[model samples]
Target: MDMHILQALKSETRTGNFVGIATANLSSRSELIAQLCEIAGTGRLQPGLRILTDYVGASHYLLARADLLQEAGLDFVVSSDWPFDLVTNLAEAFVGGFGRATELEKCMQLFQPHFAVLPETADVPDGASRQYCSLMFNIGRSRLALMFLFDDGFILSQERLRDVGLLTAYYTSLLQYSGTTTDRDFELTDRELECLFWIAEGKTSDEIAMILGISRNTINNYITSVMRKTATKTRSEAIAFAVRNNLV
Candidate 1:
């Protein structure tokens, strides 16, 4: 099944429509690797595995940041149609069964290679039950799960799975950045970021002005400028957006 997939990929590449083949003029392995590499780029998540899944036969994929688990106070699950019930149940277990330290340790330990079938009790979605292989691996600061619901006979390689892990981490990290309160380059100014931090901490413009030794009017102007630049409205909404995008 794996070889067949690769053959299909090669054939598709020749046809000139394959997503992974657009830059096939890549002359060397390093060039190929760079083209396929999404880890170091900036975004909420990398698109490498997502693109791979599309090129292959998988319907959907998910990559969760292990480090985010600490700040979010929850285990992150990235998969397609993984039942909300299943996610809630497993998240409860993750919360109860492991401490922050333990979870981090587990993520670190799995960095090389790992994959598995979800337990029978796991309430996988109807769409996912046929092929029904939910596998996980860790890479750098994140953990990822790739669940495929294609034909039962379909098989993916260990090497490919490792690539999925690496690619997923890259995507997830990039996505994490996209959702962060800070932008990748230039970043918000010190004053702007200071205001944002305070807003997230529940400070009002008047309070921020007092803290920054500026007048309330000046603080309001700064906030208005921030809203325009960030393209957000309402302080609370802005803060939420910042936090979600990893801007803060």
Candidate 2:
């Protein structure tokens, strides 16, 4: 994570919705906050995430970057306590489903909790639910999701789940502030990102071409390729997607 991004998040924290978590009546919320504070002091991310998983009544947790889901391997995973075989079996299907979602849909899903059913072939832990909960949030330019599997027949509190999402973002910010955030391998090329930056600045293909000394058709091709790779439908949506993920 970049310092400027962390600084921006620090400023936002002063006015962000997380400030209201303290006033919530849930005892788990308080415990979550206390544990997070302690983790902040100790600088251990996994323990904090484990605390969040327990606080939410989840049997297992997996935190990952949403944007990097298309990549090979489990490189996108930030932290996880899920069974290794389950993750291996599900990663491909997860990436495919994530890619099918439009950029607009992905943007709209930020900080919103959703549920999905695990594949029947997955080797789940005993008594864990087939249904899993996921919540997405942005930490600077990164779009991260926290997905967890709860016990069978245990009802999840929606409020606590939302609080967990917010706290996960806060926990990631703590990692950023301590310079322990994991390095990311972006999928976009240098030229692709350069084109994205220009388009985000409201430049037309021709104008960008003039600035970059490329032909208008080539510039259009770059923008189109960006849209395809990003799973966006149009130039505007592509720019919006780039901005949300901090690609520019």
Tell me, by lDDT, which candidate is best. 2
Native-referenced Cα lDDT, model 2: 0.70
lDDT of each: 0.49, 0.70
What is the per-residue lDDT of model 1 for residues 20-42, given as tens digits with 9 covering 90 to 100? 22322212324335755634454
**What's each prediction's TM-score?**
0.44, 0.63
Which portions of model 2 show Cα errors greater than 4 Å? 1-27, 180-248
Name the runs in model 1 displaced over 4 angstroms.
Answer: 1-49, 54-59, 70-81, 96-104, 107-110, 116-121, 125-153, 173-243
Q: Which 10 consecutive positions of candidate 1 have the poorest summed lDDT? A: 9-18
Best candidate per TM-score, number?
A: 2
lDDT tens digits, residues 1-248, model 2?
10111111211111111112222222456667886887677767789888887676566789877765543567467778888998887788788888889989988998888788788899776656677778989877567889987655654566677778888898877675555322231667788889987775557888999999989999888888888888888766776566445464
lDDT of 1 at 28: 32
Tell me the lDDT of model 2 at 98.
81
